[model samples]
Target chain A: MAENREFFNRRLHSLLGVFPIGLFLMQHLVVNHFATYSPEAFNNAAHFMENLPLRVFLEFVLIYIPLLFHAVYGVYIAFTAKNNLRRYGFFRNWMFMLQRATGIITLIFIVWHVWETRLAHAIYGTEVNFDMMATILESTFMFWFYVVGVVAAVFHFANGLWSFFVTWGITVTPRSQKVLTYATLGIFIIFTYMGIASLIAFAY
Target chain B: MAEDHKTIRMIVQRQDEPEAQPYEEEFEIPYRKNMNVISALMEIRRNPVNAKGEQTTPVYWDMGCLEEVCGACSMVINGKAMQSCTALIDQLEQPVRLEPMKTFPVMRDLAVDRSRMFDSLKKVKAWVPIDGTYDLGEGPRMPESKRQWAYELSKCMTCGVCLEACPNVNSNSDFIGPAALSQVRLFNSHPTGSYHKAERMDALLDDGGLQNCGNSQNCVQACPKGIPLTTSIAALNREATLHSFKSFFGSDYHH
Candidate 1:
């Protein structure tokens, strides 16, 4: 029974990635796409998300809790796992290494982004608005940082989705996994487009 | 006279005690025709002298079946995990470095505690069940095609080198590594062993079982017997998935 905990924890990690976290990531891309449509729509969606009843409770339950668990456990996995890329230069091995690397970079970027926006509002009484986002996006350094961050986050989710299927026994056969790989690649392309488009909207 | 002066240089990682820090000791032994790493180590055991000619404690390593059958002599030779008994001196580069498999805890010099692997084997029940000592007339026969692949799986010697090469089988993670996982395929495929197939599947349904593998593909290359460890893992994943579905909807659903 004690031995079973490791299996469950890993499954849970995979589950959380696709469900609340992956779903949230997709919805975030969609909301940012609203910026491509119009800033008013983007701000309105953001306002609705921020002002939802039990907003703090929802954030705690949905966003913060899952993100905390995934990020912390991911960091633990990254530190524990070894990489032998020199000997095994296979594509999957490199993907495995990239997954961990992107996970770490995404974690740092997420923390900084959250602090700059949400935490700043909470701790310093700063208002979050289109001007603020536009100003940050306009900065050359911050612009490049977000670009890298968005790429890392999207790639991690897309690749993670592929791994999650195998880890949870969802797609066991190589053929099925190959199909899912295409699907994940599509997700990567679509999400990346949405993310970059939103960032471009902020610049303009 | 110059031919008689040939020597092989070796650098071995040694530890005096289990709790002691590991240190490197270099040795140069008179080159002999067709000498393997084990032969070189035996010479060092005989001489107990470093390359600098200083007296030292005899180097310790585990070995059985010098032909690499028992897998008792596996260690890292020049950054590759393999059976030392089969590692020929002629094929190796100079200053052949020998170190104990790091995946397992060091017991002493070139000896490690492989109990974790055996324990995982037990957990996965890598065996055929026997009800009694009495012989039953004519056990069920396996198809030749199936038997062929099963024979491939049976070649595993529990060498612990696969675990040594694996990145997930580190100190921090409880991953059972690849060898035992492959054994799961081995035992589950046996005619009589298939009777307890569900139980074996259940054993691997836990943390260290299948989930810990990050798909690094090192174990497949590191396996000295050339067993298809990853292929076994993939097959088991399919089996385990079916098992989970059966368990969820209750056994009456399907076989």
Candidate 2:
């Protein structure tokens, strides 16, 4: 009885990850990638997102609630997870450890990130545009912090996608699983590049 | 064939009592061609002498059928859990290390209590339910194609290898492990077993059930029977997911 709840909660965690959480991450990176153009271009893109109708309500329903659940349940999972990579050092074994590790890293990063940007917008009325990001990344230490945070976030998402397919029964066979591994690796590389490139544009 | 190469050095992990601390004992055996790990152990048993010029109690292990089918003689040989019956001396590295599977309680040296796996099997009801009282009308037949793959799952000998390989099934956690999870899929897929599929699924939905899998994927690779364990897990994941939805939003479904 209670186990079913656990099962549902776990599946919900997995589903929420790829659906709203993972989707929002990709969208966020693409929007930030606009920085590669010019300040006006990036500002225009950021402003366009900010001006969306019912933005606050949509953010709560689609982003904050789901992200909160994923993060909370993810922490429970990470705390309870036991790693055995020393004896069973298989590829997937390493991946399992990394997933948990990056989840923690991503959670810390997201909390600080929300405080710096979105929450700043709400509390201090700071504009979430190019200048704000430029100042955030201007510091050498903060720039490296963003680099670690961004890479961890992307890796967590990409690896989480592979298990998402399995958890949802999308790719069940070895051949299908192998194919998705390569596909997810591509996703990791592409997302990581976009995230780091945008940061570089802001810093330099 | 080379001269002066007729010996095999082995380091065996020994525990005198169930609660005793495990210790190592080295033995030098007269190696022979086609010698499997079991035969080597038997030699050591016949003469329980240690390399330090001391007499000791014979090492104890579990074995039957002397074939992989029985799955009784499983141990961690050279850091990998496998059937000692087929572990040929020639294939193993010198000074071969042997240890009991740590996932379960070490009953004695190189033999741990596998009752945990059996308990899991019992919990999941890994059997088709049928009463002899009445003829349940012709059960639905399965396709030959599906049977072909299902046969792979039936090969599980319950040797406890999968659990040994899984990090999730340790002293602290009651994960039920991949062995029983795969068994649930096997029985549930059967025409007769499908009669009680809901019951088995409920058992799986309980704590220490399917949600414990972290997808380490070592079970499928470690299974001596070559069972597609991860595939079974994935299929069950889908089944559990649908079951959750039905239980939540659909008709009041109950056991």
Candidate 3:
């Protein structure tokens, strides 16, 4: 049973977790930042990908397929998980619940983001040029939406970084895990600020 | 921190069995001179009375050493997981709450089956294999700095507090959790234990071992021993990467 479980877990890690999530994070950060320098730059980048057969194929096969599987599996596990939160104490329970809540929020945001940016372009003839994004972002509502999105992304990444190390058997020492968790959070905050600043600058 | 002796109420969440439902029982223990939550629990156990002025079964719990070293007496007091041994009643709120750490299977009211953690330790071979029983004395010595931190890592009491605090450790995942991972570090750092380092590392590198942790840093805050859990996980990450690289290259690596 243990061996089978381990096998199943490894399969999930490779297909659903590391490659899809990590690649998406890196690409999302890079693309979002690029939009700040020049609206045309982002528009060109978006168009270039949309026009590429190989890129489109890879995105469909590698990104979307695994992403959907992982999200569904995550929700399933979360809902089925036993209520250990109330067993220990408040902070513990809250942290346990927070991870699940954030994961759900991220899933919701991802769907909406994809719909607004990608599906809308394909189905509704909605323009998603860098300028359009900037214009929408200039509104206080959308600005805050982007801000909240960035914060959630940062928290998710930082927390996931901490979890990833433990999951991979990289840093097992308590002291080391603590230090790295703090360091990861610090790095997350820095990137989040950068990403937010770029958004404000691009919009205004 | 004044000796302001004031009456405080305590609410304990209790369950009879693993499958049984949980219920809350309140007790009003007299404010003592210098009492912690453990002492308050002790007082209630001594009297075996509830707020309703009725006789009840003695509230059950587990404790080894009265000091914080044992980690056996760990409980959620006032919504925080820590050693009940060290919790001061005077420093707590008026109506404090207590509950068992939820990560492990509850044996009774406050006692839990922490065998899951111990089993993980066994699975990872969290120990050094030494030669024959007699006289193989003084195997090896580590650097002072390394020894100091290793000692800190060795302080883990198999307490499930960290596990209870973690979001990743649950029934859905077989996550061995922070306590076991820290133990892996403890044994892996040993010069003799390093021989089995590959096995331990491989175990952690596998599913429900390392990949399940969602680093919220709550474990550190929840840990009564204040073990640097995240730091150890980071170092293990670097080591695992190096190990993976070595494995990929099929290089001759020394323990």
Off by over 4 Å in 3: A1-53, A61-103, A113-204, B1-8, B131-137, B248-255
Candidate 3: which docking quality band?
Answer: acceptable
Candidate 2 wrongly placed segments (more than 4 Å): A1-3, A120-127, B1-5, B135-143, B253-255
Q: By DockQ thresholds, what CAPRI class is model 2?
A: medium
How far is B123's C-alpha from truth in model 2 (Å)?
1.2
Each candidate's TM vs. the true structure?
0.85, 0.93, 0.75
Candidate lDDT values, in order: 0.87, 0.90, 0.74
List model 3 lDDT by residue over A64-107, tens digit each: 98888778877865674555455444543464566567768878
Interface RMSD of 2: 1.7
Residues B107-145, candidate 3: write the lDDT tens digits: 778878888888888887888887777977887879999
**Candidates arranged by lDDT, highest first:** 2, 1, 3
* Clashing residue pairs for model 1: A6-B207, A7-B207
Off by over 4 Å in 1: A1-3, A34-65, A82-91, A118-130, A170-190, B1-4, B133-136, B251-255
On the 0 to 100 scale, the lDDT of residue B93 in model 1 is: 97
lDDT of 2 by residue, B121-190 (tens): 9999999866678887777889999899789999999999899888777766778999899999999889
Better of 1 and 3 by TM-score: 1
Query: For candidate 2 chain B, which ten residues in a row score worst on lDDT?
Result: B246-255
